[model samples]
Target chain A: MNEYTFPIVFGVFIGVVTRLYLLKTDYRQYPTYLHGKIIHIALGFIAAGLGTIAVPAIMEKEFAAITFLALAASQFRDVRNMERNTLNELDQYELVPRGKPYIEGIAIVFEGRNYLVIFASFVSTLAYLVWNIWAGVIASIIGLLVARKFMSGSRLKDIVDIEYVEPHFEGAGLYVDNIYIMNIGLPARQKEILRYGMGFILKPKNFNARSTIANLGQRQAILHDISTALGVYRDSGTPALVPLAKRDLDDGRVGIFILPQEKDIEKAKTIIGNVPTLENAIRMPTKSEANKKGRKLR
Target chain B: MTHEKLILAVITTNSNKIAGGAPIFTCDTREEMESVATNLEAILDGIAHSLSDELLIIVKH
Candidate 1:
């Protein structure tokens, strides 16, 4: 009945729609269940309500309401912590565990999306109050496009060249390209490995990418992603059958060894290329002060 | 002190090569050595690493 009623409802609706668009349960299978989605949607709704009311609060000279954003920041931070704890707990039992860095990256994304929701709601509401519904719709669309741009980070393909290599046995040592993977003594076990195992070498595109791909957590994330997508051919008791990534010290290339049940080289390569380059694992060595001074560190 | 990697057992055709530390299983031939190492690897849930043609050690990683 008030001037703010339609605008508030419109803002909240747009915010919730943006949240739903972002909360996709992709191949990562996070928030896969109905219950998990419910929890996030509920939190998103709260964020939208908070954002929509702020414009009216400001117009009424109730500047005190702006302080509620600080509270929302803390609330979203808790969502990050909750995600981290849950993923960490579940990781232990996973066939190919998502490493700490990958889990942290996912948690950060969950928290960040809520802030995007708030931004979308606030902008849309402000437009509605200032002009009309058409302005509000246009503002919401722009907000959504900005949200989409911020959501996606670089993929593995952007930084490295992935080439398939057949794993070979040099004496008893298993090697992917030139990088030594591990040793297998039993002839039967070695036979089984040769039959099932596949290898790929990741060549870093730049000096900055070398350190990033060499990160143990990043390497683990690669293994986890590929294994989840292609189905790992391994069991608990078989330690020798596990997938591994080893770095070549001479050239900064990484050797990845995996045992996938479905031996489709092209499909596996596509999966590896699609893996998100973790935020925590990114190291910008070229951007450092010493490097910027023209000293060739690499 | 606890070790991250421990050699749980050793199976070798040449018994003179290794003596102390981990429990050693001496085999008469290469076939005997391979079978013994394989069994130990499965039983102990450790990886069997070959030192040479005649020697294998099952180590927990």
Candidate 2:
């Protein structure tokens, strides 16, 4: 019917579709409930609506309408906080808890996705206003693809070599491919560890990858994900049962040990490969002059 | 503290260092600490201790 109405509705629809596509749980099955999905969809719709209306508002010379974007920004920030809190609460009951860094990363992604949806809608609407409905539809499709690409962060497998190793003990201390995991005191617990424990060695591709895996939070997140995917061995008040990740001091290799209910190495490797490299954990060795000097000498 | 009741003796290299809010006893050598722990082990009934490598955390429950 109306020129503005068609573009606005079409833009909003594309934006919502993009958001839903990004929300699909591939590895980390979180926010899978109907209520969680509904809330996200509703938020995405609002974001798309706001972005779609901005084109018409600007065309009509209503500058004050731009302020609503700032409002949306704050709303999105609150959504991030809500997500962080919910994940934190859920983490307490987990056998292996997703560390603070991972939780923060996930929350930030959720907030950023909303902004992407808004951008998609805004671009498509603007294109429609300039040309026609066909151009708007084409632009919206491109925007969706771009948003999808931007949302995907590099996984652990991209930077490191993950291989399953056997868990062994040297006296009281547990060793996984020369990396000293921890000490297992009781023989009974040691038996269970040998029987059920899955060991993995992550060999970093470069110095930067080395530093990233070395981060305590990143290692904890890996352990959390692996344990979450393959059920963790439930042992109350037993510190020995706790999953551990130890690094090889000589090389930048990391060893992870987890006693899961199911001893499936493939599933464990897949989970490790899917672990999102935490934003804070990424350490660039090239930034430091000492590292540069040392590399030249080597 | 609950750890105080659980920990029989924390024979660390550094006496001043406190662990888990439990009292720390300084021992000059590993051999000396092992002897002391052995003596304590005999005296204390049914109290099994864990000797950790990192800090030699001798935890008993």
Among these predictions, the greatest DockQ belongs to 1
Model 2, position B54: C-alpha lDDT score:
21
Which ranges in model 1 have alpha carbons more than 4 Å from their true place?
A: A295-298
* Local distance difference test values of all predictions, in order: 0.93, 0.82
TM-score of 2: 0.83
iRMSD for every model: 0.8, 8.0
TM-score of each: 0.96, 0.83
lDDT tens digits by residue: candidate 2, A1-298: 7768888888899889988988897556888778899999999999999888888999999999999999999999999999999999998877688988989988999999999999999999999889998899899989988998999889999999999899898877889999998765445657878988889999998888999999999999999888877888855455457788999988889999988888888878888999889988998886788867754421
Residues A179-256, candidate 1: write the lDDT tens digits: 999999999889999999999999999989999999999999999999999999888888788899999999899999
- Model 2, chain B only, scores a TM-score of 0.55
Local lDDT at A288 for model 2: 81
Worst 10 residues of 1 chain A by lDDT: A289-298
Candidate RMSDs in Å, in order, are: 1.4, 6.3
Q: Score the docking of each candidate (DockQ).
A: 0.77, 0.10
